[model samples]
Target chain A: MKIGVLVSEGPYTHQASDSAYNFVKAAIEKGHEIYRVFFYHDGVNNATRLTEPPRDDRNIVNRWSELSKQHNLDLVVCIAAAQRRGIMDANEAKRQGKDADNLAEGFRISGLGQLVEAGIQCDRLVTFGD
Target chain B: MFTSSENIDPDDEGGVIKKFMFVNRKAPYGTIYALEGLEVVLISAAFEQDVSLAFVDDGVYELKKGQDTKALGQKNFSPTYRALEGYDIEKLYVERESMEFRGLTEDDLLVDVQIVSAAEMADLMVEQDVVISF
Candidate 1:
């Protein structure tokens, strides 16, 4: 099955990101193809490289980055949502006159149209939220 | 649990029409969830999939009439519910228990919706291929 995951909340505050991560890992292990993981609302915060937790704790941002690296996953954060919460890539940072970009590795900021496209293209669209 | 050894039916493959249900359980304006949920529904409508909408809990407030967000300096999005039918999205289900809990009636709603029991709504959700909650 081609699965598309939509995460709508940030890590720690909500269980959405963690649930999505676990589901994605399980799906991949069961021989399913993850077409895309589209992050919206506070979920865009997951793509910010500036996030740093305790050394002993599980790094959610790094986990997502590593998962994307290992599976060549398409991780897309909503540009509109990201801009509202200050998550930007280098091009967006330059255009918006920001000091620096903090978008984590293996994630790209895109539009909500990508979410719609993912729904149509993928066999199943699963959403994780508060 | 799904297994790799299990054979997938050809009819249930790539081109199969999927039932997509957008479940709304939050109130409007207070959080960005309701508005963003609407944005997703609008985008999903263009895909021409089997789509159904459910309004439960505080989500029933999203369809209430006489919504004046101007006091809060927010956009009045209550009127947008009326335009959903134009996009070919006619299946709108509102939970009876939720409405009763909130003291809301069908007459108070801006748009027409099918009033269903909580059990009926759950059954509908179970029938869906995908359920996106907001």
Candidate 2:
């Protein structure tokens, strides 16, 4: 089955990102196709390359980026939410006249339409958040 | 103004329209969930899908009439609820128990909605292809 996941919470402060990662990984292992993983609300924080964790702690942002690389996943961070939270790609940063861009690898910024499209096109749409 | 380059016309995809329900369970102001969830609803309206908004728990407060955010310095977005009809998104359902628990009635809301029992709401939810809660 083709599935789409929505993650709406930030990392470290919430377990939503971790749970979503595990769920997506398990879904892929079980032969399910993940159409996309949309980061909305605070979930867009997961796409920031600037995130740093303690040496012994799991790096949630890198975990998502690595997972996307391994499975060729479509990791989309909502542009509106990203901008509001200061998570921007190189282009967006330049356009908005920001000093630097921090969008992590394997994740692209898009509109909420992607989330709606996932709901329409995918067999199921699952959400993880507070 | 960022848009999805892969945005496809629903008609091009064989016109497969699915039931998409947005479940609001949080208060509109205390947290950002209600407000942000509404953003998705507004965007989804452009996709021309069978969309519905369900108000449950503290979410019932979202539709309450005469909401004044002046002192709080927040934008009073309750009026946007009434504009949903312009987007062709009129299927608003308010769970009866939630409304009663909050001591609110249909007359206290800003927009017209169908008051449904918990069982009826469950039936409607079960019939949907996607149900996103906030």
Candidate 3:
């Protein structure tokens, strides 16, 4: 099935980021086509290049980068939300005249059209949340 | 009648808008639901949806007055709810029993909001063509 996964909560917070990593891995192992993984709300924090997880744990930020790189997956962060929360690419940082670019590589800042487009493009839209 | 997949008729201007109901059910300080709910509400309004936001359980925290996130160094979205009316997505409602359970009264909220019983909120939910929860 072509799937669009919505992550809105705690896989990026108090719990481990393993949930995000395993979610991508499991979907691939199941032979599913992931059309897009949309980051909204606090999920945008997961795409921040500044995340520094412990040395023993699997780095979910790096995992997302690999998944996006290897599969050419569309990793989108809502641009408006990203801006307010201080998560942005270099171009966005320059445009907003902010000194820092915090958004991780392999993730693009976009809009709701991508979410709506994923809904139309995918066979199923599964959400992973709090 | 034009469903979501159908084209809008030039003569029927009101028919062109997509109607959306957002059900928000989490507390404001701990979860991201409130922020995302407002985000989707604004985005749906941008797409020209006749959007309404209904609060239940701890979701009532979204409208509480004197919200201060500066102490935590978090971005304060409390101000954004005020901007909803500007987006034309102003139908915000709350469940009466939920407000009571949370020890909140209508005046505790920042904006002028409607209060409805859970039963009435359920009825409104059915009227929406697309119901999205946050």
Return the top candidate by TM-score: 2
Residue A30 in model 3: lDDT: 96
What lDDT is obtained when candidate 1 is compared to the true structure?
0.87
Best by lDDT: 2
Q: Encode model 2's per-residue lDDT on B25-84: one tens digit a residue.
A: 998898888888888898888788899999999999999999999999989888889999
lDDT of 2 by residue, A42-76 (tens): 99999999999999999999999999999999999
Clashing pairs in 2: none
State the lDDT at A106 in candidate 2: 97
Give per-residue CA lDDT, model 1, range B52-91, as digits (tens): 9999999999999999887899888778789999989999
i-RMSD values for every candidate model = 11.6, 2.4, 8.7
Q: Candidates' TM-scores?
A: 0.87, 0.96, 0.67
lDDT per residue for candidate 3 within A51-77, as digits (tens), equals 887899767787888888988988888
- The predicted structure with the larger lDDT, 1 or 2, is 2
DockQ of each: 0.25, 0.60, 0.11
Worst 10 residues of 2 chain B by lDDT: B1-10
Q: What is the lDDT of residue B110 in candidate 2?
A: 94
lDDT for each candidate structure: 0.87, 0.92, 0.74
The CA lDDT at B121 in model 2 is 99
Q: Categorize the docking of model 1.
A: acceptable
